[model samples]
Target: MTSHAQSQAIAPKGISRFIPILSIGVLFFIFGFITWLNGALIPFLQMVCELSEMQALFIAFCFYIAYVVMALPMAKILEKTGYQKGMSVGLGIIAIGCVLFVPAALTALFPVFLLAQFVVGSGLTILQTASNPFIVRLGNEESAAARIAFMGLLNKAAGVLAPIVFTTLVLSGLPEVNQELLNTLPEMERAALINDMSVSLIQPYVGMAVALGLLALVFMRLPLPVIEDNTVASVDTLSPASQNTQIWQYPHLVLGAISLFFYVGVEVIAGDTIGLYGSSIGVENATTLTSFTMVAMVLGYALGLLTIPRFVSQQAALLGSAVTGFIVTLGIVFADDSSLLISEILWGWTGIQQLPDTVTLIALLGFANAMVWPAIWPLALKDLGKYTAQGSALLIMGIAGGAILPVVYGGLSGLTGGQLAYMVMLPCYCFIGYYALWGCRKYTW
Candidate 1:
């Protein structure tokens, strides 16, 4: 096949399509808000439920591992429902999960809350499967990373909002609460205070449920142009190499899936675990650090959108991001875990900034972490042809790493302490660096 045919295969039209693309971008924005909020929730749940580090991080395990259990099934479901209907259905499922949170909060039951997270993750699994590939297929294959970066702009923007909003609502006065906990308060009164705090959780989830429900209805009525995986081989024209019955035979896709596993793991470690790490180190504003991370990510995505293929190839961008991630991982681990105070940040725009040396290093990771997904999705999904969804399922399932790493970090932090636990992220980035430098191009057929 000529380059021209390949281009034709991927690009359905000469014009830049808007509605479907923007719609999917909005979905990804929701994804960022939901996924990254776990950072704040880690500490919040730990304090509220009076659980240990291991138990609190089970929030990540319950939430992200659902992607593994649901990804393949979502792929199959999308085949029947198609992307548009599948997304609407997925939104509905998320709304149901959001509603489940109300009762979980009412009972103050941790397991019930995990159930809600799993349900929400299941819905997100469907949305991710339907949307990532759909968005990638809409434009020029060479510029796919740039397009995804545009969505990342929206995504991290929401990520920036989620932590600030969630922590402000759910974790407000947490410092005072901790200080009060150190004093003698009546047990019954303390329990009453905790329950009142739990009520704060109810309103936010109610708002999410209503938003998701409305979005589902909007998608049902909206007419999106029909889309297909342009990157997939027709299977009809499958040569012996392409005709392999197993998706694993596509070495790039398999490695890509594995890469995503580590990518997500490290990304979560940087964003989610940092809050707890910050709190452990006595940063009063630790709950809001995820916003700083998200801001850094937005900067990275902005750079990616501006520079990719124009200033840097996607593979080169990945290589740089991985190297930066590895170095930041080292910095976070080896840095002095000391705390400092600042009266103003952003030229006195924000009132106070609590700078923990280790926390700052971890948050800097958002810059290193931003370009990985944009690069990974396009590289892994490259030329999967008819196996696109199958390959996508495996990659989505790799999100289970989010479940694995944070819990490991929690355990390691419990054992060796917070700063040392970040060493776990080092090898994760080394593998990512390896992929960007080698794996994506190693088995080109």
Candidate 2:
């Protein structure tokens, strides 16, 4: 084990350790609530802003690309601020971004909304960089994935609520917003309807801004235990032998980053695009479709909480996730889009809305994806010691896949339709399966 892991083994025991984990879980909840809002925002903005499918996905692009652009810089800031204060700073930044949405809504401008997304994403970059490593290093290395699974449970739970809450607040009373319907109306009436719907964003965002600002204050004063590793700040002080071991020398970490890129791509595609796909297939209240994906993920995380490090090792769980993801992606690609048979067998009696077969398959992808992040983080950061912070930043940068791949899906969906476009996920799962089986174990290139 690395020195950092050894130090963590002697970290605060009993209730003290639980406090930090609980605090970080709150941060993960914030991450999910803000990040997954893009799912509903995608179709909502597409209608409000008069965008094509590809343009609509730029909502995801501008949001996630900030991770790549700002991660290294955020790492630098964390080195100076330390993890606790940096989290407070991150929450403050997110609050600022949320406040920006007020102006974006008032003007009904897409550029302004894009700007708000970039700002919110930039803030999340800091929180993600700080909080992920914090959770991994807080306990025994063997159980780290389990800890992260618990956090994932919280995150995905928030994800389940975010879209439903968004649909309730912003879309509840609005008229249907497809272009065909708009084109059928008088021009003046269409503009007025779009303007009314756009402004519906104001109340919820203002509430988010206030709640986040208060959370920032609470986080700033929270009594969290501090870990004593040098992180990135003291890298220059290492002996020549330690300094000679460049981050590139760790093949597992590098490959893990690449694997994470594909993992996040498929995760975002499943979470965000499901709504748009449902809309195209004539599902009512398509914005709430993300809740179905989130529900699946929540179930997966609950399973992980029970089995990880006990009934199953993190590595085995990861392999299972990849295999399941591969099978589900195939179902998404080939399932008959008009069939409600899958939904009927699954939840038809619950009185919940039944999705078409293809859409149901896409939601199952969430179950396949839930374990990937939890499993990968501990495995990738294993034995990095003082390089852990840098490794975390690298993995965080891999989230760019969320920004890039969905746009690719959007463009491809335009050509081949939404169902077949899921073929893109096949190679992604293949790569993740490779990582789970072999790439994670190869420490040397």
Candidate 3:
């Protein structure tokens, strides 16, 4: 072959390196789709199952707590099987979980649904354990932020679409349907109608199971490179020796972890509770407002895609986002109870208009949360060499903050009412702000 033709052949081979990373992005999309659907599910399940606020939030607890419970074991599993096999196994587990929804829906049993969600989350823990470190190891460490940012776009885009799709199917027109059924039906028929409504979830989960199965088959066929963890035991980033080694031992990683935890909590709150919050403040049709939250998240992902690396530093993006989060929290706190200011600022730019104040603020939180995960993961995993996988596992565990913080918000809403209950978000943003500033700086140890 001519030298130029040989170069062209090698170029495509080099481009193949990105295929694994791109596949990881697809996994991220699946994760986001499942995770963000909790926003719609919490309220829908609450009404169907007749749950209290605290009880409803158990949806989040069930889903996210799996990360904490399963991260280490998942890491070990990945170590034994390698990324490709581990990912296929994880997807299989998730498919099983999705299938579990059939029984859960048939019984209209809330705890059964929670159990299925936990199982799905356990599977996701394994997927994230493999995918995160895989992306970081794909290329230059310094450029990890940009790659993660690209993944973030895929992840959040799924997050944006999930609520809109699920709500439309399950919750959007339920009241009207219920009203029509009530007018024409006897008491026995009314009970059957309500039960049938809850059971509608079965078909959606069946579709999810089929999609997961196809993705698993495809992932099994893909060519994925394995990246070994190379950090020394004594020098491990998350080791006990490293624990007493001062917070500065890995300033960027620790701060990034903290930022990730708080960012997740805030994002969960925004997406999960906004619909309920809208009801509390007298928005007539609350579930419809959930779209504004997804739209806001989509806008943030769009901005990150355009602006990260080329237009701005990840650190700067994080800092600015933290400040905006703080401001939005304050707006939620002090804004007029009935004003559309929050919704206007969040969705008005897109020609979506007159959203409820609660939803608007929730959507705006999406912007503050946009760059956080992408920025923090790259910074945390930097220079970890061998411990990169374990560190990534720990970061995945930090997702439990989503489980915890929303329950706290729900409890606060129960005690103090929903509008004022947003006070909980203030402290989360405070921690994020701290991480963005002094927390993300270099370590000497």
Q: State the lDDT of candidate 1 residue by residue for 199-218, as single tens digits.
A: 78998999999999999999
Q: What is the TM-score (0 to 1) of candidate 3?
A: 0.87
| CA lDDT of every candidate | 0.82, 0.88, 0.75
TM-score of 2: 0.95
lDDT of 3 by residue, 170-222 (tens): 75545554232354778786667668768878888899999998889999888
- Please estimate how well model 3 matches the true structure, expressed as its whole-model Cα lDDT: 0.75
| Model 2 accuracy (lDDT, Cα) | 0.88
Candidate 3: where is the Cα deviation over 4 Å? 1-15, 171-190, 231-252, 342-353, 442-445
Q: What TM-score goes with each of the models?
A: 0.92, 0.95, 0.87
Ranking by TM-score: 2, 1, 3
**Residue-level lDDT for 315 in candidate 1:** 97
Cα distance off (Å), candidate 2, residue 409: 0.7
Highest lDDT model number: 2
Residue 137 Cα positional deviation in candidate 2, in Å, after optimal superposition: 0.9
